[model samples]
Target: MHARDSLDPSRSIWHFIAVHLRRYREAHGMSGQALGDVLDCDRSTVSRYESATLRLKRAHAEIIDRLWATNDMFTNLVDFADRADEGDWLLSLAEFERRATRIRMSDTSVIPGLLQTPDYARATLMAGTADDPNSALERRMSRKAAVFDKENPPRLTAFLGWAVLGQLVGTREVMRDQLAHLIELSELPQVSLRVVEKEAGAHPGLDGPFMILTVDDRDVAYTEAASRGRFLMDPFDIQEVAVRYDLISDIAAPVGPSRALLRAELEKYS
Candidate 1:
């Protein structure tokens, strides 16, 4: 996932376990309520466990293993959960980005997270089905803060599709504010912003948005769809995406023209 993509480490461990639980449950044709009954917990608890909102206890894991007939997956999950850290995943990304020397990003429908304004983020959060939109917005904003912390910032290169600049994420005023923020951010010395015009013709990134984060030792790619995002660490996949990104970069407008394009779009909202 991108540095801005939120993942709770504590929840991730539990999420991994929960996925196995779901697999085992489905394999046995068991409903959540039925599984909850076996574990002597409420059905909602089972749901929460599966969703990674709550961790599974060893006793509960044992019960699930017994009921689902899994050999040792539950036991392994219990051990993994017990040793999981409670740190926010964003912090780890922040640390990595801070130490990283280069960052490259591409966005198709909207600005990438690190370059988003609060108004843009709020609109994005409000558009989501999240139970706590405000908290989600806060988390997103916090991630953005890490990129511009001033202590040690990575060189940022962002390529945004022309369609993204035209998207009215919120009210015209909000979009205007967002575009202005984008213009300001693009002017930062360490940051370079480019626009991939709609008429630039078809390209590999026509598939979707992705980010390449480069640290001293390794490079990681993050891609996302509507509901979920993934971190790509395999060297081969990263290299492939990197080549595609470089191709896209070649056709995108340079920084100056990109800023002008953004400014012109922002003017429409005024």
Candidate 2:
């Protein structure tokens, strides 16, 4: 199917701008190549924008606004759409975590957000966001903080891949404090912390990290990638994540040994 014909604009936040761009372009009797010439891009980029598959950068949006004589309407809408899409996703995930009765997670690179100390969180956010790190840090930390303050917080079982324990994030002191925090949380009644050693060999979890959230009796799976988070609601997909979690957890060090391992790592930091 042609990308343009298959687009369902109603499902896209940028669809409003896309519709307007196409309408204005057609009304002006301009071809996609003609519009691309003004924007310094190609026809494919123009088609992608009109199909809602790609969003325009501010500089490109500026050129479009001037060419189409739409004043700042296109640029304003683009900005609003970008922020709304990002904010809504983050808000929904935070709400999901709050309502979950249980959260099972696997981390292959670094400590899970819920287990990170403020220093570790701040340092990690700085490395990731680069721009406006403080704002991002505050928002993420707030979500984690609120989740734990609930009167009946979710039961959390975190499976830390072997490499996660050895990965260095932030300063040694910050890492020491972070590991100390993990050890303390491991002792909690509702939290289970396990260390999956590399000796376990390859497993399904090697695919990527994922979380299974249990709300009421339903299970939802969440995975994050660069600049986006995906939620899997299909029972089959959710079940697969649950099975992966179980397999990874099976090879993880038990609570007693996990605590000892953490303490040994902490000693090195000291």
Candidate 3:
């Protein structure tokens, strides 16, 4: 790590964890690849975590604690870091997502990030970030667990614009795989997937994609643009977004038909 990078921990909570992670790993004379082997991940993943490009998951932190004999220190720090991370918009979204009991979203440009496959996410993230696309891709993929948690998964309803099916992201094969994954996810009882037809034309969703995350019976609205993201906290703002979601949802094809639509599109790619 560069000297300036090493000294940046005081500016961000994740940097503090990163600095210590590198310190303890090196103190034990362990290479990044060696540490990753113990963690059942790759060297790049370990490097991203140490650089704060990727958030350290709680389970990973616990394993590190045991490996380094840190006595739950890393565990406590992971918890704090999750709550304290405010430097990255997506990171904050991941934090709130894990706590949400319900999620409703509408996407016009592409598949929502939470529901994206690795290849799909990589393609989309690569178009956005010039610095480290792979790290951003991994960070986005890590957040999917919020929707897939078997013990207490959030109820997710996603409305995708019909154009999303036709848009070419990475490759024909990538979209084929992603559409297949969507079919499987739609089968889950807690997930409701729908598509707004191109014919639906100029709906409220044309403005942009937005998400409503429900936590403790309260809803928070999140909107993402090319350059930045906004988290709407005012009750009125959240309610308005919720209302728009309902308007869009009403026009979307229900899950059964949506799966058929996905399979139909899958054939084109195949």
**Among all candidates shown, the one with the greatest lDDT:** 3
RMSD of each: 12.0, 12.1, 13.6
Task: Summarize candidate 1's per-residue lDDT along 168-191 as a digit string, tens digits.
Answer: 898888888888998998998999
Q: Spell out the clash pairs found in candidate 1.
A: 1-231
TM-score of each: 0.67, 0.67, 0.68
The Cα local distance difference test for each model comes to 0.75, 0.79, 0.82
- 1-270 in candidate 2: lDDT tens per residue? 343554345555565677878888999999999999988888977876785545666788888788777888888888887677443456646756876789989888778888899999998888885578888888788889777888988899998887887888889989999999999999889998988877888877777877887754457788876676766755677788888887887788898898888888889898
> Which candidate model has the greater lDDT, 1 or 3?
3
lDDT of 1 at 175: 88
Task: Compose the digit string of candidate 3's lDDT tens values, residues 1-270.
Answer: 232263357655676788889899999999999999999998977876776545577899999999988999989998986565344566557766876789999998999988899999988888775478877777777788755864889999999999998999998999999999999899988999998987787899888989998854557788988766777755678889989998997788888888999999999987
Of models 2 and 3, which has the larger lDDT?
A: 3
- How far residue 70's Cα lies from its native spot in candidate 2, in Å, is 32
Error of 3 at 207 (Å): 0.7
Quote model 1's TM-score.
Answer: 0.67
